[model samples]
Target: MLLTDDIIESSCRHNMDFDLKKTLEALLLSTAEPILLKDVVKVFARYHQELSEAQEAIKGEEDEDDIAIEIPSLVTQAQIREALEQLTEEAQAQNRAYRVVEGPNGYQMVTAPQFAEFVRLLRGAPRPMKLSPAALETLSIVAYRQPVTRAEMEAIRGVSVDSALHKLIELELVIVTGRAELPGRPIQYGTTDKFLEFTGIKELDELPASDVLSNHQIDEWMRRSEEEPEEISDEDVGLSKEPKPDELALDEKFVEVDWQRENVESDAAPEPESNENTPL
Candidate 1:
């Protein structure tokens, strides 16, 4: 039967063996995206409320055949969590193609990784998205260091992020949140809901710890970036230093010696003739 409202209401009022886990399983399978825990609880709340209203309406002149079938109490969040856990276990036990996974946002039913190729084939998958390495790096910085400005991203990446940032914004993975309260009030960038969706994470906190940069280290970078920099020479960053007066003189002496030695070697026949005359 179709999952219509009246049908759901009827089920809520009439079902004797209502299984919470099974109800969630139905919900998970029905949704195209992850469902929030609070949303699931609210669905049940509304169901129970509607059932109570219907019960009250029928109580006035019910026929003898209408039995008082027990309606389940309002399901708690803990109950919902427990039910979801059971659903997860059940899916695993059955070696189902889909599994119930929970993330920061809520729970979702996703196809098991082992079935990815099958699903991909079923969907006639499109060409894989091509993100430039630079874009990925910029996206990572934004994901980990968000509420960050383009300047900060460039600082971390050691290059301009304009192109990469623009691409990410176009892809709906990143967005301009607000201006940073810095000297110029630079615009800050942040990851979007689509970013979490793309990454298969429910929220930002679910983002895995970065191996290249931890939060603390990023914080330090930001802190240092904020401070006024001291005067630095090219040598500070491994550039060649200008030769000092003494070093220049030393170099000139070596050049003079090398040049004289070259000239003397080239004129060896004349020197040998002078020495041969002395020997004679």
Candidate 2:
């Protein structure tokens, strides 16, 4: 005998030993990385299979109709999708600090952007080794426009990026991937595994869409720059000066002088003869 839809639904409802939504939530929360749909489905199927076997053992041999009624049916992919959707909506409705987000690989639980300041405070200020603005811009260009060349980067930024490229290479965020097939065969720059690790992304495709500056936006920025007062000094903006080689050498000389003075002062030296007789 074939089992009816109603019977299958009723059996599933009665035999479900675990809440699907809660189980999914727990699984997502337990891992920092995104979880794949297939993995989740496997777990769901296992639960149904175990429940069906337990029911069969308890009920003993039965007719096809009876077995069908006693054993719970496996969950459909549709049901799993529905559960994920409901869980996502519920998290939003409850104003949760974290929510399920669709990443490049799959779905992941991530903290809300609104609480970033609080999270930063909890984690303390960024380390001194954090990338500089120029380096970050260079990295972004490399990420979006991989297999790029130094000349191409300079053309885009309208400035030489020798130092920025050096810093990125030192940090292991960028690497030289083969050379371009151009005249000079310039070395092409691409991101590295360390870049993905630093960015907390599983792959390059997961990077956020690029926000290219429009011509109007560029004009507006130029206008704003023209409107701002000129004659601003680096010192006024609290920017530290980079020490020059000559300045460093002078500093070393000053340190030696101080050390010599300290040594002379500490030594037991005889005093000069007094001029009291001439004054009298």
Candidate 3:
């Protein structure tokens, strides 16, 4: 039989002098994480030793059932599990949910993961800043690959990205610190402290909200995009109007004009070698 309140009250009033409620509350609140069975037993030993000393001072004997003595210490695994189940049932009866979650070496109350997104929608606070589609895509690229060169970021996004990057810089979400050592020394970009605060995360590792795409699916999508045929414009397909040649033709002398290209390859073969490479 477990020790009842009558037994505890009689013992404390007659022989024992300890404040059992204070003792129990102290032990329960001390645990930052879930208390294990072994640890519970060890804490029980210490409490029991103290109770025995107090009992001897008043000349009282130890009782058979340990609940009276045990209530002052950390709870055993079985006891905690039973209490949790009972709490869960009581919560369900009232149309509420209760959870015992382990976090950072402690147990804490938390809402179910499935309900998190729904809660977010219910709260519905507007974001601190609004971003254009291009700006959003540019920010994502910088986020995933930080300290990336401007050219590298452009390569991944398949765009010039200059205006978007400039906009982000103006918004103070992205920063350009220094130049890369690569040829021509392109500039490098990375997110700022403002970025983390705006995204509501303390660190970059917390960025992913969910896992949906598998690597195989991503690879297949990329391969299909590369293999797809290019679409021709309406003008190229002969659907739109074409201007009369008379209106589009260049002047005769302008057609003969030769313009110099800055980056033209000098090692290429000359057009006519027959005239000894066409005297300059």
How big is the positional error of residue 176 in model 3, measured in Å on the Cα after superposition? Answer: 1.5
* Candidate 1 lDDT trough over 10 residues, lowest sum: 1-10
lDDT of 2: 0.75
Clashing pairs in 1: none
Tell me the deviation in Å of residue 142 in model 2. 2.1
Q: Score residue 63 of candidate 2 by CA lDDT.
A: 50
Give lDDT per model, in order.
0.81, 0.75, 0.60
Weakest lDDT window of 10 consecutive positions for candidate 3? 98-107
Evaluation by lDDT, superior candidate among 2 and 3 = 2
lDDT of 3: 0.60
* Candidates' RMSD to native: 10.2, 20.0, 15.3
Global fold similarity of model 1 (TM-score):
0.68
lDDT of 1 by residue, 67-169 (tens): 3434567999999998899888988999998989886568989888889878889999974477999999999998988888988788888899999999999
TM-score-sorted candidate list, best first: 1, 2, 3
